[model samples]
Target: MENKQKKIVLTGGGSAGHVTPNLALVPELLQHGIDVHYIGTDDGIEKTLVHDIPFHAISAGKMRRYASVKNITDIFKIFKGTKESKRILKGLKPDLVFAKGGFVSVPVVWAASKLKIPVILHESDYTPGLANRLCIKKAQKICLSFDTADARSERSILTGSPIRKDILDGDRAAGLASLSFSGDKPVLLIMGGSLGAQAINDAVDAALDTLTQRYDIVHLRGKGKLNPGLEGSDSYRQYEYMEDGLPDVFAAADIALSRSGANAIFEFLALKLPALLVPLPLSASRGDQILNAGYFEKRGYAHVLEQENLNALALVQALDALWEQKDEMVSVMGNSKEADGTSNVLNVIFENIGVQ
Candidate 1:
């Protein structure tokens, strides 16, 4: 066989969550001698995340849950994106398409199906997202993070969420040093998703005086969410985002306090790091995070604090409880079958593409 046996296109992104899993699969694809191409929206986060690859930009239409004037206009954009995707896929003639679901991926998958290119979709959430729901019939196989009895379908493969290889290489000391932390106290990592969770930020800020005494805080406050007033606190550090050093932070953290997005929580689980999860309420999202957190909680990997009951006091208390059970939680996570889905997802990809 030649060094490169097949070519494939990876599509997904509207948020960091969608792109990271696809990125996780890149190294293995390259190692297997398969060519990789990426298709994403011109300005979506995927373009930035997939910079090193051969990237194709297409228009993406975000379908919102609620009624909006923009939703009507987005229809035209979706058609344009679909057309652009078809043209790109035809020219590339990739053997397969591996899509991590997002608004951007729906068009790409549809285009792939129309062109008779096999498509595999990886769903990170327990339940399918809107984009995945739309493209399910078009996909040749659906990969699931949650492999429960109810989530099973004939076309579904039980692949846990793919975790980036870099995320597991974090050095605890390097992580502490990066944050200027003394390494004396437990490091608590807080992530509020990519868009920032105002409620989590406000609660953490309110509980800082108490929280800092026992833990060194490194807060990923999301874009433009940093509080200037908390700048000088010795035990606290805030960054808009961390990409290069995120693994180190993950390594340094003994316990994490975060919103239960599937990708973030799975990252924590993969590292065997115990977490206290605060899920987005139903009103905010489709309650996917709530289900993601509940799954972890049921498995003893994390603790869940619903948004409705979240506040400064509850945040501090829940974290304390998590700390008390950290060792047990870590033990459970160490043995969890769903810790990382990278390998399983790769197996399905290569199988579909007939590369291996």
Candidate 2:
């Protein structure tokens, strides 16, 4: 008799950070003969990004840290989402549910717990996000990207962020050809997440001449943030974003300037890409990026530049210093034990699902 094919439901959204890790697992899961389904908010970024898989959309409510009138309405929305998610889970009857922390996952996690389905929650920061904090009690296992993260329950396991395997197979020649550049100088890649960083964007543009003189610049300037006037510069290239071509870009880059998001930084570490991290300030975030940057900086894998101190001159100076120490940074990253967590995370999934 043929064995039944195991199925898994992945739920997470709100931002790219919450979705990418789930995506990194899809191909691997499919290869292992596991059927994959994803649950996300109808209007969330996950809906757009998880097109390759079977996607179910449910209404999700944001759990804001601060009080507001929407809180009352959102409570109803949360209840509604939970009800919808429960129905979906009942019909799918998946063997396991894996959630990456995001507001959208809260409803799905609650539904899974109520139905007595095994669920694993992955947190990608030094501290648990509000969503994961609420879902911890219900999760059978919690996977953490940072070892220092507070695990309220003994079920938590420190598994570094999962990085997509394809990202590591980039071709340097193809990457340079994509930008129509000759390998005359070192390439510096600047990225500020998917939405782009306004401060970093402005500083990069302002310091273009200074930067271009020392390195070939490849900047992912965020959507709608490109300067049309700077289009034809020989040593600089600007892109809003690249999906399939990103790996090649990584292959082409010698160093990187980026925001210190856990998923992105971990990928950089896995790739051994020397970076100068500029974390979002406390005014903009909950200081997770600052903590992420500080951890890497202390480990000698990257350098940190506080967002508040960022400017054209400061950016230029930091890059220069980062370049000087690039070899050492790469060495530390190569030696780091927490580089990739794809296999560790997969082990958790298989263990919980009773798949040997």
Candidate 3:
């Protein structure tokens, strides 16, 4: 008799930072004849992002950095989401659960553990998120993007972050066309991750006119509504989402104004694109971005700007400095190509699943 095909459940969402890597993992697992199921909340970008995939809907609620009256609502959501997760896991009976870090992952990880199903978590930050932190003790393995993550868990492995295969394999020409950029001028790619960063968007808005005059810009605005000024810039183009064709944007970019999310940071490294990072403020409960930014700043691979001190002029000045150092920055970033994270992570997962 043949054994049943093993099922692997991936729990994550709330932002592209968490879901993008898991999305990159899906095709690889599927090719091996393993079944993949996603567990995430409907409220986040996941609803639209994971549309065609087999996903179990559950509500994990929000994790806020500061105390909010809304925190009361989140408390109840955690309990409810946990119950939903247990029900879903019971039906799927997956051999393992991969919980990508976020508040939405909390319920699923909790449920998977309670059911005695082994769980693996991927932490994309140098500093772990609340959900991954909660699961660190319980997870059978923790795959991390940074070496520092090992401090958070005894079982953690520094696998870097999983990047999409296309991204890892993409070339300069592939990215340029995919991003709809002509090769005539320098391109500046702007992104604040999936949900967008109002602060970063605001700074971009402040500098748009000046920026567009010099460079053709690809602004991935995410879900944030556009600033009127950006909408009107002759040299600026906005995308609510990139839809799996990010390489062109990356390829077209001579410099990037970006948030320091682990996925983007690693992808930028893979592309060898110089970046000016504006770490999201602590108010967003993302100390991870700060650590990520610091790593590059310490290495001269990128520039860092804290949100509190940011303004249009300062942003312009920073861009000027990074642009002037383009060759040096690119050289520093070139070394980052050594990190092909997806393959490393997949190897670990395959090993865990006994698929050598």
Best by TM-score: 2
The pairs that clash in candidate 3 are 175-247, 175-248
TM-score of each: 0.94, 0.96, 0.85
Model 1 regions more than 4 Å off: 1-4
Q: TM-score of the candidate numbered 2? A: 0.96
Q: lDDT for model 2, please.
A: 0.91
RMSD of each: 1.8, 1.6, 3.2
Between prediction 1 and prediction 3, which has the larger lDDT?
A: 1
Give the alpha carbon lDDT tens digit for every residue of 157-224 in model 2: 87889888999999999999998879899999999998899999999989999999999999998899
Compose the digit string of candidate 3's lDDT tens values, residues 1-356: 99788789987887878888999888888988899899988778777788556977887777676789888998899989999999999999999999888889898998899999998888888877777888887789988777663635667777778878777554667766665566677888889887888888888887878887778888888775665554655467888768666665565578998889888888887677888999988877658789999987877778998999899999989888889988997787666633677877888788888875
At residue 315, candidate 3 shows an lDDT of 92
Query: Top lDDT: which candidate number?
Result: 2
Q: Candidates 1 and 2: which is better by lDDT?
A: 2
Q: Total clashes, candidate 1?
A: 0
User: Considering only N, C-alpha and C atoms within 3 Å, which residue pairs clash in candidate 2?
Assistant: none
Residue range with the least summed lDDT across 10 consecutive positions in model 1: 146-155
TM-score ranking, high to low: 2, 1, 3
Q: After superposition, how far is residue 2 of candidate 2 from its true place, in Å?
A: 4.2
Of 1 and 2, the candidate ranking higher by TM-score = 2
